[model samples]
Target: MIGLPAAGDGVVHAVFVALGIAAGIAVFAWEVRRRGLHDDRLWIIAGTCLAFGAIGSRVGTWWQQVDPSANDTLAQWWMDGNRSVLAGLVGAWIGVHVGKLITRYSPSTGDLFAPAVALAIGIGRIGCLLTELPGHPTGGDWGIILTPEHAAALGGPAGVGLHPTYLYEALFQIAAFAVLWRMRDRMRRPGELFVAYVAAYALFRFLVEFARANSTRNRNRA
Candidate 1:
């Protein structure tokens, strides 16, 4: 039986997430330059999006942790917060529009951001794969089977194959990136590319959530 490794330290996950964010920002800057968008307001928009995205992600995770028994202090929650990618995306979208309204800069920047977001998500999911529970049972050999010790540490069932949900998401993001890259130039509308990417990702995420054991709706399983 193939064995999965134990979850890594929180610090490691944080480092990967930070790296992903930095890489995403770099990519966004590059794309902006390539498109000859020399708007000084772009940086302001990016900063706003980052700030709101962080807050939204943390809030979303905290909301999802609906366990009544888990009585964590506010400081503890802030220090070691869980985050949601979906929430971050939503927050970033809102931030971008709000920033634009504030700066009165009228241009479609979605095409520039779509690929960068996909790349960032793909990189960040690597950390999730390394540190979080895989997902629901796969009921097949073609999945990650965590060792007894590792499973115990993660409070998951041992000696069973589970879906590598994070890996699936990472692969999906990569594919989405490729598709967005190819379709960027073909999009007739300014924001169409980003809209299409977001729609595709939302559908993917919705289907994938069904295979998540930790999903709130799946908690009452036999």
Candidate 2:
């Protein structure tokens, strides 16, 4: 058992999430400056993504439960710490299009946002690794082992070596960031790099789900 400290988990998660957002914005700004494109309209797209991403994160897992009654109320869901990154990405994708439509900025912003998104996910996942359910048992010597209290709180088993799925995701994101950074200037199209990154991540996440505690197999076993 890794014995993660459960105290102030929510606060720590929030802090890290904020840091991720700030880091993403900083990276975006740096990219914009490096490109030397002076279109103030890009900010509007960024703002729109932020607004929509927030909404998506809140509502993404709203229907995850088979029984509607088992789900959180809208108000509770909004106030709670729970979120869905996949849904948030979908929302941001929508936001980018809507922002471009509204601003009439025809250029592809995907390449600019790609690395930033990867870096943000890399940092944000640390919060999840610290506070959320680790994952299914590794059946091996290596893995996180939570305290009984923490395990109960996170809804996982105690005294078992659970897969550190979140850490795996964090590492994946970091690797994605590196790959994106290196390929940024080599893509034939402006948005091809972003598309490639998203596609790769989608596949990676699907495979990683097998080790995640929230997977259908794990839930059934639970």
Candidate 3:
């Protein structure tokens, strides 16, 4: 079956995204107050990062679900579906860079967004547990338990114990936040911190993907 085909009823993803951005804004405000980098322009930085992140994630998913090569009509493609997290991050990255061209924004802004995005993703992953068909399997030795029905909802084995990628991502995000917090004082450059953050996350996710049981991207698991 093609699953229930719903994007979670509670809008948890939306809420988490909002909260994560809010948290980032709060942190930015705090840093400005503390470091005396207080500038109205900082708000613009935060806005651009968060806005583009969302836009990127959405676009990536849209691209994945639409098989332009197979689907002929625009409406048919639109009605298809979306992609995975990897795709979303790619989308977010593309969106940020493109937005930079249009607005002439700086890459340094990524530093301000790093922590907030991490925090937001950690929380948002929780929502995925409650909504959407999770990438879980049938009974696990030490894994998540989704009903066969639920698994069917997400194209997975219902009632199996599958890898809790959401939890995995959440844990790594928390770790990323911790690392960023520790590096905050020593960070030499603005964009450097964010670059490190992204690199670290990519590595962490890739490592954890090794144990993932339901993914299709063997070449790039995470």
Candidate 4:
């Protein structure tokens, strides 16, 4: 995050993001195809929402962590992993509604994605854990042991076991999936389940931060 020329901010991570966008689109596309959404517009609308949502989520995460004067340069602050998933969730909502205004898609599309987005969150948390990135790392009883590669990637001196924050997030996301699944059909509104999921995930993250190593995150990664 610290060494990129404007390219990092520009399109340096383009491929990775495109892959993520494609994956998200593919998820929505699978839904559309499975449900027989013959309206090509549905694909367009879903694509637009997922695309903008991904950008907004990552950018929002970056924006939340950026504080000028905290670092000599903006990039320094913005590159930290301390971005806001909450903001990204909001972005996803906005992207869907805005795409609806532009494409006339219905809220049902958002409903279609309710469980999906949660699954993605749960999946992405695994990426975070595999790298052995820093976290609270308390009680050795239930944490992870990293290989030399993970340690090197995370700047650990090697032979150290981290708190396994990625695993924590993954487990919590699984719980979130269960709760949302149970509530999806019983809720009064199409989006209520999603709101509950967001709130629940936020609480989960807040609680888990206590086990993370980044004291600043433990203090304030929300």
* RMSD, candidate 3, Å: 5.4
Candidate 3 structure, TM-score to reference = 0.74
Query: Candidate 3: where is the Cα deviation over 4 Å?
Result: 1-7, 64-80, 83-107, 136-140, 212-222
> All candidates' lDDT scores?
0.76, 0.82, 0.59, 0.56
Candidate 4 on 74-129: residue-level lDDT in tens? 45434554444566667777777777888876646654676667666666554444
lDDT of 2 by residue, 1-222 (tens): 465764227777778788888999998999999999789999999999888888888776667589999887898877753578888888898898999999999989999999999999889888878777878999986799877776666667778899988889989998999999898899998899999999999899899888888532112111
- The better candidate by lDDT, 1 or 3, is 1
Candidate 3, residue 51: CA error in Å? 2.4
**All predictions: root-mean-square deviation over Cα?**
4.1, 3.5, 5.4, 6.9
What 10-residue stretch in candidate 1 is worst by lDDT? 213-222
Q: Per-residue alpha-carbon lDDT of model 3 for 1-222, expressed as tens digits?
A: 122323344456557656766775677676667767656655554555555665445344443435567533545433433425565566556656665666675645666667766776777666564555445452445566656555544555554566666667888887888888777778877778779988988898787666565423211112
**Model 4 clash pairs?**
61-84, 135-212, 135-213, 136-211, 136-212, 136-213
Tell me the RMSD of model 2 versus the true structure.
Answer: 3.5
| 2 or 3, greater by lDDT | 2
TM-scores across all candidates? Answer: 0.87, 0.90, 0.74, 0.66
| Pairs in clash, predicted candidate 2 | 1-145, 2-145
